[model samples]
Target: MLTSLWQRLRADFAMLLAFLGFAALSFVFLKLASEVLEGETMTLDRWIITGLRSADPTVPIGPSWFETMMLDVTAMGGVWGLTLITLFVTGFLIVARKYATAGFVALSVIGGALLGTGLKALFDRPRPDLVPHLVEVSNASFPSGHAMNSAVVFLTLGALLASTHRSRRVRIYLISVAVGLTLAVGFSRVYLGVHWPSDVVAGWCIGAAWAILCWITARLLQRTHQIEQPGAVPVEEEGGPP
Candidate 1:
């Protein structure tokens, strides 16, 4: 009884800390974004975007090979790519008899994408034109859609997969890959001259907050028996002769 109580207390404390951390991050990012939208951060935004370009405004700061690599990296965060990945994972979960988990994954990614779209429309910030864009883009850029969606999908997916495993190292590896992908995609946007640094920052903040909230909600549901724990071990029956 004592052990179980201690475990529950530890879990609750962890969740509380996560909530506070993400909340603080979201506040800071939104504050920065508000300043940017108010034109208070225009000079800083322009400086960072332009800094990624060569002396010749048309050329990107990096060599030809680097540009190609960034474009490839950016594509991983694109809508079609993320959608495909989500669908594939959802299908896999269904096949594995984890229906609730499948629904959660679908809801998390689709909801985050919709939220990103709504936020973009609300802010209606224009794409940076100070430097030539290596890739074509047409949307308001207050918060980077690619950056936000990638963070949401990757982090949420990472957390879900990590939960199924019992190994600490495996969990760390999954989360590190998710973080790495999110950062790479965000940086690729800046390097390709499609988004301001502040946009990516805002995206990361909002996405992380959203992912963490979803995780907390899922845990609550599991505790309340609203959903079966995806990582719960199945009980085996005693055989007649073994």
Candidate 2:
């Protein structure tokens, strides 16, 4: 068992290395760190420009709509919503899926969410100041919390749903829906002027990396444990064999 545990940890390390490698490719947006910040500033500037240049009174969904949407999303991405989502996911995993798998899913999401929060806090980026504020917030704003949380939760849950099915189409559908939601929420941040493009992109990259790391770690651990199927272990005779 000790040997197996070491092997599991080693395997997990290797898998994590591989995940980082892949993430390096899929999440190359890190190179754009400065550029991303610049773009965000520009995007926020656009919001201000649009407001200043607003010549039509008929456009209801202009700056005001965007502001409302951003604040609303911020609220939706709050701890309450996150807690509810977590509970629902954990319950589903416990009831419908294997406990180990469920544990992995929950851990990955929570870890990813925390990571996003950390990044936001460390960066200490401010939201766009180009437009008049509709609602007030007091957190660093680079990546949108809603985008990060949605990405983690949706992708993790979708992966779980996909893994249970043998049908490729079903898997694709689940993945598609997950991707769609992730994109929608991320895009909404930009559209609403609450986050810069770079912020959302970074959120996506980090969130994805966190999820992949969790999955690979879980897989490696499972391999180490080497679970046996029901009755696969031979039963010893009670009174016959010495």
Candidate 3:
């Protein structure tokens, strides 16, 4: 009984820490976003954007290999790329008979996308014209869509999948990959000179916060038995088709 109580206490403490950390992160992101919207980050944005370009100002600074690599990284955050990942993951979950998990993943991505669109419209910030864009872009740029959606999709998917695994190392690896992909996508936006540095920062902040929020909500639902624990074996109905 004592050991069980101790484990419960540890689990509760860890969750409390997570909640607090996420709240702080969201606050910081919102603060940075507010400053960006107020135009306080313009000077810094210009410096970073210009620094990434060649002396000619129009050309990107990196060598061909690096640029080529970044293009691949950036594409992973793009619409079709994210769509494919989402569909594949969701489909796999459904095939495994984890319908609730699949539904939550789908909702999280779609909701995050809508949030990104609304925030872009709300801010209506323009793309960086400080340097030539390495790739074509046509949208408001306060918060990068690529960055936001990548975080939402990758992080949510990672966390959900990680819940199924028992190994601590495996869980860490999953979360790290999700975070790495998010950071890479955000950096690619700035490197391509289509987004200001602040834009990517804001995207990272908001996107991460949204993913955390979704995770917390799912946790609460599980506590209330609204949804089954993620990664648990699917329950077979006695009268249902196998």
Which of the numbered candidates is closest to the native, going by highest TM-score? 3
TM-score of candidate 2 versus the correct structure, residues matched by position: 0.69
What local distance difference test score does each model get? 0.85, 0.63, 0.85
Expressed as tens digits, the lDDT of each residue in 122-187 for candidate 3 is 999989887778888988987899998998899888877776566789989999999999999999
Cα-based TM-score, every candidate: 0.92, 0.69, 0.92
* Tens digits of per-residue lDDT for model 1, 34-153: 798688888888898888888898888767998899999999999998888889888977776667777888988889999999999999998988888889999999799999999999
lDDT (0-100) at residue 186 of candidate 2? 73
Clashing pairs in 3: none
Q: How are the candidates ranked when ordered by lDDT, highest leading?
A: 1, 3, 2
Q: Higher-lDDT candidate among 2 and 3?
A: 3
> How are the candidates ranked when ordered by TM-score, highest leading?
3, 1, 2
Q: Which pairs clash (backbone N, Cα, C closer than 3 Å) in model 2?
A: none
- lDDT for model 2 comes to 0.63
